[model samples]
Target: MDIVPLLDRIGEPQAAALFGLITGLIFGIAAQRSSFCLRASVVEFAHGRLGSRMAVWLLAFSTAVVWTQMAELSGMMRAEDARMMAVPGSISGAVVGGLLFGAGMVMARGCSGRLLVLAATGNMRSVVSGLVFAVVAQMALQGWLAPVRNWIAGLWITPGGTNFNLLTSLHLPQQSGFVIGLAFALAALWLARKNRVSLRVLFTASGVGFAVAAGWVLTYSLSQVAFDPVQVESATFTGPSANTLMFFLTSSPVLEFDIGLVPGVFLGAFLSAAWGRELKLQGFEGAGSMSRALIGAAFMGMGGMLAGGCAIGAGVTGGSIFVGTAWLALFCMWIGGMATSWLLDQRGAVAQPGLHVPH
Candidate 1:
């Protein structure tokens, strides 16, 4: 938490990168160990079942919400300064983009963060899809698609351009997030009990949330002490994947949080998979599956850029802090995911994961 000394030793950018590495490491290990995936959870929901997958996800989501709220309440972090709050956002983008991202994740059979983690574990299908995702994300961010993203996002700006906190917008109590998080935690516990989820899995899932909190505290702490300004942010994959890609392609690369975060996650996942004996080379089932994954990746790349976040980004990170756009996006994601899952089921493919991995 005390980052001034670290800043003095390595300066601001390096310090921030260090924090991102640490955060990503924790998230990767936890996510891999716990088998956490929003796609899996959505699959369960689509079938009208609350299984271990649902339990793990709810625990992670609630944990992030609780810890993030507590940090802000205790004055350990200024959540308000985070770009999710301070910057103008897009309502139109959230609705449209969330739907696309939700459907894309179903087809891809994983979210952006999930793809990266699986790729680190030697999932070849994920590797190809992830690469496609990063490239498309780069295009969306600054290449041929920028104008489209900007135009769509410009459709509906945040009320007054920035005064749209979810809690404030809804006139809810100040501590509503904490209260709701506690409720969700209790529900998660009950579901875990019913689903027979083990304590080890739950603990690992909690680490996923802890990483979100650590990301916030670390970056905010650095901003207060660093000589140059640093943006306060937490974990997300779409933008960072695109940014890391650019870092590698550029003549001159800079070390920053996004750069550190991606490789840290890869290292963490590789180590975790090796330790767990879960490392295996898996590829797409056929051309059809490969096409599905690639198409899904493209949709996610575009949607994540337009929405300003992916599942982990908006659904967990921004949702924890009660961002209005984030919650709306998260809600729409569930709807999109469920609807896509149902359509796939009707088609008899269920957009079945290109290759099989243990649940």
Candidate 2:
């Protein structure tokens, strides 16, 4: 789908936004229907639910890996040419940020992507978390907290760094990286086979992976369009969340894919919720829930920026490309999530009468 002529015909910004909208809409629908929440996946695993939803996450991520590689192999898109691949990054930032983001996701009850879907489905808690996540992400990116973020990021930033992944570090062929990614994905599928999985979970996860891969292909095509300054990237919710917020605050006519994608998620979720009769107004349980949400959202926003992406962005999309930072972020996120689950258990035990807290 050569988009150069399309850009020439309908204009670059419109074309990009349209493509983003289509992908985002599909993502939102799949997510809404499948209950695809990374945070939940982690929590369930910690609680011994095993491969049920976790399988969904794995399948989606694996699907993305396969599709993204296909695009690269077919000359439709090159992962190495993406901005995240070109820019210098911090390993410390990825580790620390992922931990923070993971902990926050547990407290907030969802990641930024899940919040967006919930918000569209009339979840007030999600609305608050989504807004806070966007605002804090903006702060970490270039707002009041930017200096702090930069300082921490600079601590581990490597100039002209290579070997951020096993394949690159080992000096192996790129095909080796593809194999590693597929192997992990396959392992996830195998684990998921232990439980009775639903068709909705399978289909939704596959769609999500496809949506992510499509985002890459679409953005790459837009980058090839003449006279347009489209960034070669895929769906990363954290930065895009901030971008969506900024679009409304400023008076610029910059119709970016990010902006279109954000709203597209909401619209798609709204439609799915309506169709499924799942649209219902919900709010925080009390002051405690609200307070937890505030802290969680703040952490997620800052952490996501520091880590370079959120679950979908870095974990699924970036991980699919076999990047070093994405792998570290994913590992640390699991650790952070597990730790938070333990803490939550302790806190719950403490709150109960005649309950003895474990050492």
Q: Which structure among the candidates has the greatest lDDT?
A: 1
Scored against the true structure, residue 195 in model 2 reaches a CA lDDT of 75
| Cα TM-score per model | 0.96, 0.94
Which stretches of model 2 miss by more than 4 angstroms?
A: 161-166, 353-359
- CA displacement after TM-score superposition, residue 124 of candidate 2 (Å): 0.7
| RMSD of every prediction | 3.1, 2.0
lDDT (Cα, tens digit) per residue for candidate 1, span 1-359: 67677677887778878888999999999999998899999989888899999999999999999999999888878778887888988998999889999999999999999999999999999999999889998998899999999999889988675727777777887789799999999999899999999999999998899999888888888888777778889999989999899988999988888888888888888999999999999999999899999999998999888788999999999988888888888888888889988887766653454533222
Candidate 2, 1-359: lDDT as tens digits:
77767877889888878887988998999889878889988888787666677888888888888888878878888776777776776788898999999999989989899999999999999999999999999999989999988888778875575425546677988676557657867776686667767767788877888888899899888887648466777777999999989989998857878888999889988998999999999999999999998899998999999888998888888887777888788887888887897798788887886776443
Q: What is the C-alpha lDDT of each candidate?
A: 0.88, 0.84
Give residue 113's error in model 1 in angstroms: 0.6
